[model samples]
Target: MLLVMTGIAAFPWPAATAQQKGGFRKLAPGVLTVIPPDKSSADELLHGDLLEVTEGLSGPPENLAWEPQRSPANTTLVERARNRSFARDIWCLEFAFKPPRMIEVDVPAADLKMQRKRVWYLVYRVKNTGGRRTVVDKDDPTKFKTETFETPVRFIPHFVLESLEPLSDAEELAKYRAYLDRVVPTAMEAIQRREDPRQRFYNSAEMVAKEIAFGEERWGVAVWTDVDPRIDFFSIYASGLTNSIRWRKRQGAVINPNDIPGSDMEVAMESLRLDFWLPAAGGNAAEQEMSVGYRGMFERMTLGSRVLEATGWPKTTKSNPAAALERMGLKWGDLLEPVGGGGPSMQPLEKVLTTIAGLKDPAIRTALVREMFGDVGEAALESLAAAAAGPVDTEQDKRRRAALQTMGLTPEQVAKDPYKSLARIVGAMDSQPGYAQRQAMAFKCFGPAGRRLEWLSKGAKAARALAAMESIAIDPNSVATGNAQTAFEAVRPSISALADEAERRKVLQGVFGPRGPDLFAAAVAVHEGIDHDWVFRYESDGPGL
Candidate 1:
């Protein structure tokens, strides 16, 4: 069903008298596409009206004496054939997206009954912005001009979901699952109800390959089913939204006509790549916030999550390891269960503290602390890294230092020569990243028998337990507010009390900042462009599970 009511607009056709922001636009001179009928010609593909080819360009000039690789045997079909009167077509659509969301909707089944399914969907809006581009002028065919014109643009949307989780190079190479967009007939209506009932939304297929004229905007939703809820990180490659492309011609004595555009010929489609991170994915997880990121940012996040998970840091910190990472603005998560258990046991805080206090030797205490905090050993080893910084000039030193600062080097591998090593310089940090969070948390000591200790106490649970019992909640305003009943109470009332509302929160927070549901409502708001959702799930990271 074409839910979009294609109506005749007020703005005149392509080239109107005046151009308004959200109105119909006019086509400039030479606005027509020049993609010829025959695409089999490699020459045509390589150099269109835009006969642009980059070879040994870009990058800053460097002082070096090295032999450039020359494949003298390699030759091109048309060695010295050239044509001018060209221009590059780089038309773009204004694209913006909301974070991916899941909607439980009913779908038509084989037996004709409606089967409810969980569909993961992304919502985005695209508008033809009447962009400027260099084109061969119609008036003078030899000359070129940059004009802003809104031409008819047909959107043939192609969306592919790519997992960005890094395991090992080999495992990661084959570890990902690329999910293609699906046409879920049943999902459209359900998504609309969940999103905006007033607006019309189209799926990848339903979006007619018809020209979306200038001044018009379209909303689309690409959906997928059977997406791994266990997916920690991924990127959505949205293609066909724009008709822009870039290519690197195979440089040689001759352009081989038989050459497949794989290694040598680089044809890069201009697509919108959107990265997202689902911090928590499994059934045991909570509020799986789908965070938006640039390309590869999610990989760092997953690495943090996985590393902490492997170390069982959440258990040590007595807080949700995932939540800890988010609170500290660290892109991270801890989420995997590799079968079969028995590992070295972590000593409880009380036991560790007792043993530490009893140890007389300073060296042994230091070693034990190092054992408890592996970053200490890491810090020690990192102290000696400068010794390897042999003979190097200022440029090399600056380059190497920048590479060293990468947290797994997003794009930081310096090359003095043909140093073929994509390998990163992995070292240890002197201190863990999230160690110094000065933010105050609502804390309460629930007496001696161990408080889960809820907070990261570093063996201070014994003291917290003592404090919980000795502490009493009192309000002098009970008499003034006519709630004198609190004074008459024997134990001064439980944590939830007469003055609870005034103070405003948990017995912990009520005594401290008066403060602050859920995943679904937040997900809905995210679609509407209000991206806000962060919650500390546990009432109290207190005593028991």
Candidate 2:
């Protein structure tokens, strides 16, 4: 049992020769070693570490070798994996940067030279382990069964290094120390700025891999959450320069694919240092944040949700999600038991169903329904055939009559396949420019023409309501002022008649950004002929519905 403990106490070891594994030239007097998962004596990497230290690149005019000192802290074991396929228990190494020390790099402009120092170390390797677990089947009571499973324990660490130059001067050192006292927030903000764009909840790194240039150096860190359900914690650094230094994690997969040729993964990060000169007393110092955590973080990643803001999806009560279903006009009793015992208690309506039903324009809906659902939505339209025979009085009715007339179908032909007949009826109604005109006409209608559309067939009702919705422009203000009132009146009836309240509410949820359910209720009130007072009341209070 390799119990990988962590500590910062330094120790010395006997001199060793640099071992070579293809392009990974292992450093002598090594800090750590990696045994390949294959467990082959030929495949074992001798006394060395996993940093691809590149030197003598053309940019710096003169670049000296990064002479690595064995980090003062002993290598802490961050994870242990038993790969039965390789028949080996692999221990992943982690350690922190020793004290920051100076390195010399000559710059070209004006022969200017600056003393620079960096503290770089591998943090931890986030990994998912899979194996077969043998358990007695509770169902059979005495039967033993083996099940294969995978556990996702995502170990995410952010490496931060702050360096200020000219340590030879006591005043410069004092300024650097004082600056460290104030650099926490600034350093945090810098890290946040880089990570925010990449810090999304993705199961696999592949999702964001396209967002980043593969194998090219980037300035930010890439982040991913465990695809599986697990509680992951991150260390919160305290105010001091070394207030809380935890065990280091492996940077990431290697940067140069050629380095570890044919290896499935590479080091995730290449650089883990940030350098900033202290401000000249009152004047601010130029701070440069350097990072490598973004690279190789996406390898072997499973795709998952990319949640940027919790505000977008507010958590509702889970005790009775069925209540929400009831509110959506679906009876709780009607819902089939979820196939899995421990999933959501209520079966949510298919998004497509609500999308088809809540659409703001009948013409668009007709087109989409025909294209997307095809024969699938035919059953839902079965009941509408009877409505086609109902009296045609209002302009909405005349429009339906025009649609049926265009189909040129006899009553005998309509009765044989009611759903198909209804689909054809709507499809025919959609063929004319008058379909769109009537929708807009209903939107502008202040009298019975708009109100009477409620009695039309479900398809016509949905279309007319959608057309009204299209008429009103989105308004950010809660009060029904200016064009907001027109927009509200247009969508009011469509939303009210929608069987799915959540879908109804979503129509206004982000109509102009995060207005929430109140806007939906206000629209409903306008449709109900209550007008300004109720709409204002809904806006002032929360969504009363």
Which candidate wins on TM-score? 1
> Residue 539 error for model 2, in Å?
52
lDDT of 2 at 232: 15
lDDT of each: 0.41, 0.27
Error of 1 at 247 (Å): 2.6
Count the clashes in each prediction.
8, 21
* Candidate 1 clashing pairs, residues 3+ apart or interchain: 14-25, 14-26, 14-27, 15-26, 75-254, 76-254, 76-255, 305-333
Residues 356-455 of candidate 1 have per-residue lDDT tens digits of 4355675664555344434432243223222113334566545545544443332222232101111112111111122121111000001121112222
Q: Candidate 2: where is the Cα deviation over 4 Å? A: 1-94, 97-324, 327-545
Q: What is the TM-score of each candidate against the true structure?
A: 0.41, 0.17
lDDT of 2 by residue, 1-545 (tens): 11111121111212322321223223345222221111122111112222222311211433323333674223222111111111111221122221111112222233464322221112121222222334558899567555543221122333322221113211110111111111122233333343243332221222224222111111222222111111111111211111111222233433342344223222122122221122123322113221221111111010000011111111211112222233334432232222212211111223223544555666665555443323323333433444454344487555554445556764345566543454454343333344344344333221233322222232221222222233243221222233423433433444457677655544433221122243233223322221011001111222112
TM accuracy, model 1: 0.41
